[model samples]
Target: MISTKRVFTSSPFMMLICGSLILALALGFRQSFGIFLKPMSLDLGYSRETFAFALALQNLVWGITQPFTGWLADKYGASKALLIGALAYMLGLFFMAKSTTPLGLMLSAGVLIGIGLGGSSFAVVFGALGRAFDPSKRSLVLGIAGAGASFGMFAMLPYGQFLLNSMGWFGALIVLSITCILMFPLSLGLKEKKIPLKEKRDTRAALTEAFHHRDFWLLGLGFSVCGFQVVFILTHFAAFIQDHNLPLTIAANALAIIGFSNMLGSCLAGYLGGKYPKPYLLSLIFFLRAIVITIFIFCPISQTSVYIFSAAIGLIWLGTVPLTNGVLASVFGVQYLSTLSGIVFVMHQMGSFTGGWLGGMLFDRTGSYQIIWITAIFLSILAALCYLPIQEKPLNVLKATMQPIDKA
Candidate 1:
């Protein structure tokens, strides 16, 4: 027989650890997609815009579907949803290897992988983890998982390079496809914990409350800038480094530095979120990002400078993720955490689509990335301002002013 008491003691933390490993598997491989830019575009006979557009589509599709994915995770079960997502992710990677045309690439890499990411990435797992822990510990749990996700970025770049060098890109994708199946085992651990929505409001009532909240939109807008800045840099920065006559190894190492630093940042942000206001932490992160980007661009391009910039930016990279979701959970509660957080993340995706597409389009047109870099600075400052006015309070604060709904 199963001991219910034993399950309570170890399971939540175990689920958090398992969720972290799963996120590393999903996001680590996804992060390395940037490394494929030069090789894939050249080999496929496609322009940078074509490749960029496909990735942009991927971000858009992920954003559009995330709410539904979150709803599924909440209503059915996150582990089941994750299992399905892992299969789609593996299938997407497998077909991406065989794709010869823009259409096939877009469908496989953009649509299928996007759906896979919507279910398997931090969005789904964080929701599951949020429910597993107490509200006070939510940020800490998220940070641990966020650090694990960041570690994927830390570990995957060099691994991807090794595979690229030895097995070739197609072979690398095939291997990665097989790697996606590992999520099934990890998913098993998450099934032990469940967040019953009956104790909280229904999905529609939560959605209705969130959509009416001013802070929700403000947070979403700020998150949009977060997506824009990071994805643009991730997608194009290495190529930009090469354009400066630096070594490819420098670019790769710089990326590794960013990832390595982010693990610490994710954890720090989580700790800070528990004590301080998450919106404030978000503002500080964006403000720092703007400063980092401005300095990196105007200064001389050298290997040391690249590493410094990478490390500085990396420290703040995914720090916002835990804090952002932390803020949402703090104010609204975790019952519909997945759905609400996913809705907010949609803004981030829209920004991702814009940032990736704009960088490539402007590069093809102007033969430079200066304009987009400047635009990022402007957006960062704007985002910092957007988070300043968010009122971090419970959704229950509105309960007195509104009608009660049947949670059952």
Candidate 2:
């Protein structure tokens, strides 16, 4: 039996707390980005696609750089990666406030913010936490960290709205930039001593092996749906609310509710993943997402239906993170979890790029979000089907190769 007291006192627990805080601040601000869309685009006289493209670029760059950032965290230390991430994130937000042209927005919000996200977000945080806990506790700990992020979403959305109302987008961004600086102090808790060069060789081998593995591709493909659906909602739901002639507060409240429900869902997923098959849980999640989305789209748009949909969908929102991480850690071990997870995340970000960009493009052309909504549903079902066949058992090659390293 696991001792609760021992788990609480361990050094890793401190690391987990700090890492969770980092995600909360980073992702919390990210969740509120849609708030800037109408205001920023209207003020700058840019089309929605232009703004969306910048955000899409952000996701693309984040995906492209994740492997390198993950490698940085795995090889150097999470502290170092997070420190760089904090600085980049601060600068990104600061410059984002000063930007006027499309090029400026793309450079600041797109490129710089992407670099910041690659350094500070889920992959780096999870890799560190995965290495800290044994397998039995990894999912649970990750769930706890995930809940922290959710809380940030829940809390920060309203705060972001307040800032937007009082200080304007520029001032809100400046304040948020200042908030990012807090991450530097938190990075200290996740400090890890550098690993030896031999382990770097092993990481390359693991990367090669993962490339050869069929399940790895499937995981990446399935995860892409998550990125697509979530990013679409986060980026465009405000506009969707406006199109329907609903009050903006409804959208804000819905997003906040999603964040709150996600806390419960993430924790539940972690607990369930430990006891049941992670792949099956993943399948069920996607299926439920499809069902919820289907119902929400078919029903008349109203405050009641929107809130209900938000609560229902929110329960499964970021739950995938822990379950997916659990599957990778279970199969490959944590020897180079960051590097491997980062590669898979590229697929997710690709989906994110499509969802963010395609939603705006199609909306601008068609004047309704119906096509994208249907696409999201289709992608969710496809993801459900994809996860069903994944073999979650540890790889034999990994067992043979990583066992010696574990002993040392």
Candidate 3:
């Protein structure tokens, strides 16, 4: 087991509360960006692709920077990483408000915000929590933290819409920019010491071991599907609703319902993961996603249907995050949890980039979101299959002689 006690001085409950709030603010604000798509595009005279591509680049940059930021969190302190992230995120939002061109949006919204997200979001927060708690409590805590992100989604979506209506997108982004400054103090709550592991494997060795493990790749691949589905929805769902001529309120409410439902789902998934096989739970979540997407697409498009779809989708939304990160911590140990989790997140964001960009590209071409929806269903089924073969056995780092790594 990893040296959990030497790292954190605070109570587990306190850590969870602080960590969850950070997640809530970081992810909640990020999720609300979709609400800006229509207004920003119209006011700026940019195409949907321009808007979508910037968000897509944001995911890409977020993924690219995650490993480095995660390494910083793992080796130095989460607080430092979070400090840098919050500053970048604040500036990103501030500049994004002033952006009048595609290039400006890409630089601020895409590059800067992505860097901010890498450090301040799940990887660093959960790594601190993972190091603080033992295996038994880890998943549940992560689940609870995941719920904070859900709550952020629930709370921020409406807030974004309200701000957009009252203050306009530019002013709304400025306010949101100011909101990120709160993370600076919140980052201090996650401060941890760099306690050495009992079994002394360095970062390179840990990464090499994981790279050689078939299960890690499988987990990353499976997680990519999640990125694809959620980012597409977050970046384009409002536009999708608008295309069908539904009022924006329906879209906002639908998103809120999704976020609210996921709060319960994340907690339930976390609870179940502790008792049951996490891989199996993950498999089930993906299968359910495929089924839900199918049902939603085949059903008539109405406010009631949208709400139902949002609720159903939200319940399973982001449940994958806790379980997936839990698997990495379970199998590899928490010493390098942030670094490893960050690598897997890169895969997730690759899918996110594709989903966000492709949704817009296809829509602009065909004037429908049908293709992307179908693609999401197929990817979900594929992701479900990817998890079935994963073996969640903990690595035996303390063995007298190293066993051959699983490369299959």
Candidate 4:
């Protein structure tokens, strides 16, 4: 017989470690793409806008696929999805090495990698984790898992830079393809527990019901803003730093600082998410981002100030993932968390698509990123206000349907 006490603690810890590692590999490799922008553009004779559009397409495709990927994770299991994602991710990297034209980069880096990320990223991985842990421990586990991305960002940025310098971009991509293979081992630990056939049917019904609710739309809209802010910074920050006449190392270090600080931020956000209202926590995060960006723009540009802004911004970075997922759990039961969260993530990716592409377009047109930073700050404030009216309660339809009807 399975021991109830042992099941609660030990299994979850094992899952956490394994999940974190997989996340590290998946996110770390993708996060390093910014380092390739200049080199790839120079070699291929493509404009920065062309590269940006491909990356934008990547984000858009990922966003478009996320809901389907989430549904697959919810219906089947994360292991199968993750395994498929890993293979696709590796193949994308391999093809990226051989990419010679804009179209080649679009298919390899944009579509394939985007699909790979949609299937393999936190939407699938943490969705599984969300189901594994109870509500009490869910936020904490999600936070730690989210931190894995930050860890990847921290380690991979400089490592990617080194690879670029030592080996050419193609060689660096080959190395990353091998690194993507590591996710396969991590996938082995994510086993799905069997649900009763009746429960499975009800879960599907619940998901359908959630789609009819207005709150879900609001939640998705707010999540899109989070995606926009993060992707914009991640894809463009390195270029932005370089534009300022700062050393490339400064950009690398800045990305690393964001990753390093995000570890603490994600953990803290997770802890607080478990204890507080997730919507409010999300609002606070957005509000703080506005403040951080404002200060970053107004302050003098120096290595010290850049690092400080990056760290401060990083602390709030991806902290939204835990809370956003937490809110989904609060509204919809964990049974369909992956699918529902995936839909929300799709909206987030829409924002990501805009941010990545627009940052480049604006820069190319104005020869300045100043306008984009200002726009982000304004949107952050608007997003903070958007969360104010969200009711933390579950959808009324769910409560009504789940409760037994009274007999006359």
Candidate 3 lDDT by residue in tens digits, 1-408: 343223765677888888898898889989988889999999999999999999999999999999999999888888888998999999999999999999999999999999999989989998889988878988898999999999999998998889999999999999999988889988878877655457656788889988877788899999999999999999999889878889888888888888899999999889998999999999999999999999998988988889999999998999999999999998898888999999999999999999999999999999899999999999999999999987777877423233446556
How much lDDT does candidate 2 score? 0.88
Q: Write the per-residue lDDT of candidate 1 for residues 64-129, one digit (tens) a residue.
A: 888988888777678877988898899999998999999998998899998899989777898888
Candidate 4 structure quality by residue, lDDT tens digits, 57-145:
88888888877887777767778788888898999999999999999999999999998898888888888888788888998889999
Candidate 1: segments with Cα more than 4 A from true spot: 1-10, 192-200, 398-408
lDDT of each: 0.85, 0.88, 0.90, 0.83
Name the lDDT value of residue 212 in candidate 2: 71
Worst 10 residues of 3 by lDDT: 397-406
Q: Regarding TM-score, does 3 or 4 come out ahead?
A: 3
lDDT of 4: 0.83
| CA shift of 142, model 4, Å | 0.6
Candidate 3's C-alpha runs over 4 A off are 1-6, 196-198, 397-408
* Model 2 Cα lDDT, one tens digit per residue, 133-170: 98889989988899888988999999998899899999
**C-alpha RMSD by candidate, in order:** 4.1, 5.3, 2.5, 4.5
| Candidate 2: segments with Cα more than 4 A from true spot | 1-10, 195-201, 397-408
Best by lDDT: 3
Candidate 4, residue 193: the lDDT equals 47
Per-residue lDDT for 175 in model 2? Answer: 95
